[model samples]
Target chain A: DAMVIQNPRYQVTQFGKPVTLSCSQTLNHNVMYWYQQKSSQAPKLLFHYYDKDFNNEADTPDNFQSRRPNTSFCFLDIRSPGLGDAAMYLCATSRFGGEEQYFGPGTRLTVT
Target chain B: SQQGEEDPQALSIQEGENATMNCSYKTSINNLQWYRQNSGRGLVHLILIRSNEREKHSGRLRVTLDTSKKSSSLLITASRAADTASYFCATESDFGNEKLTFGTGTRLTIIP
Candidate 1:
């Protein structure tokens, strides 16, 4: 079945260390998004890629970055992990102008 | 920033009982969608109701939208223990943007 997949469901990183989370999809959607969800809070949109163009949310920290090497793969990079950054990172995709989005199993990041 | 707010942040119900959650948004939306997330997992798209549509149903799930009030409701009939999860409402603004603004989720617990 066509779906989105995220690698390393749980990740542990030390303070100030850099970590990368990966997401890939088989749905062939035109847009990919990355969201950060703190415990008991809404999933906050950090950034997204529409085809090859990157769009970042105004309040997203500069420490967070994303890359989409191809249609099927997108990566999130945290330059310096902080304890406050520990949370579930989710990846999602959808066709252009499509309201329904498909989400991957999220990656839980633990920053020590 | 979150665009939607779900009422009754947490709810508990017995199996076979119906569950209903309401959401209110702050902007004009092209569509409103509901999503489910099991603990420690990714979100699953449940339903989407467009601005021009007042209500829709799929399987045991029913969604209603009130554009004038900027609100929506999700009703799950005969819910089971497996339906225990967090429910979120996301809005797609009418600005032709691809981003989805999500609401703080409602945690529903179904008891067997």
Candidate 2:
């Protein structure tokens, strides 16, 4: 099936350490997004890439960053992991504007 | 601030019963969509209703949107145990942005 894929479904890192999560898609969508979801809360948009254009949310912390090397691959980098940052990070993709998004299984980050 | 808020934060029903979830948003939207998420997994797109459309259906799922009230409802008929999951409503704003604003989800549990 043509779907989004995320690597390392579960991740554990020490406080202040840097960690990176990866996402790839076979759907060939033009837009890819990263979201942070805490337990029992809605997924918060961190940033997204439309083709090669990167758009970050206004309230997103400086510790969060994203890179889209190509249409199929996108990466999220956390410069300094904090206890509060431990949550499920989701990746999603869509064809263009106002379209249905397909999501990956998500990566659960645990900061110790 | 979250754009969408789902009512009845949690619901439990029998396998053969019908489940209804409501979502209310605060902004003008180009479209509204419903998604399903299993425990510790990614979300699956269920249905999308455009701003010009009042109601839409896909198999056992029915979605109704009332732009005037800024609210939408999802009905799942003949629910099964396999339908136990969290349901979320997402809105694509009229701004024509590529990212979607997700609502606080409704956690539904179906007992067999």
- TM-score of every candidate relative to the true structure: 0.98, 0.99
Candidate 2 on A49-82: residue-level lDDT in tens?
A: 9999999999999999999999999999999999
**RMSD of each predicted structure:** 0.8, 0.7
lDDT of 1 by residue, A1-112 (tens): 9999999899999999999999999999999999999999999999999999999999999999999999999999999998999999999999975468999999999988
lDDT by residue for model 2 (B1-112), tens: 7889998899999999999999999999999999999999999999989999999999999899999999999999999999999999999999998878999999999999
Best-fitting candidate, measured by DockQ? 2
Lowest lDDT sum, 10 consecutive residues, model 1 chain B, at B96-105
Candidate whose TM-score is highest: 2
Model 1 stretches astray by more than 4 angstroms: none
Model no. 2, DockQ: 0.91
Instruction: Give the alpha carbon lDDT tens digit for every residue of B1-112 in model 1.
Output: 5799998899999999999999999989999999999998899999999999999999999999999999999999999999999999999999978989999989999999
lDDT of 2 at B14: 94
lDDT accuracy of residue B51 in candidate 1: 97
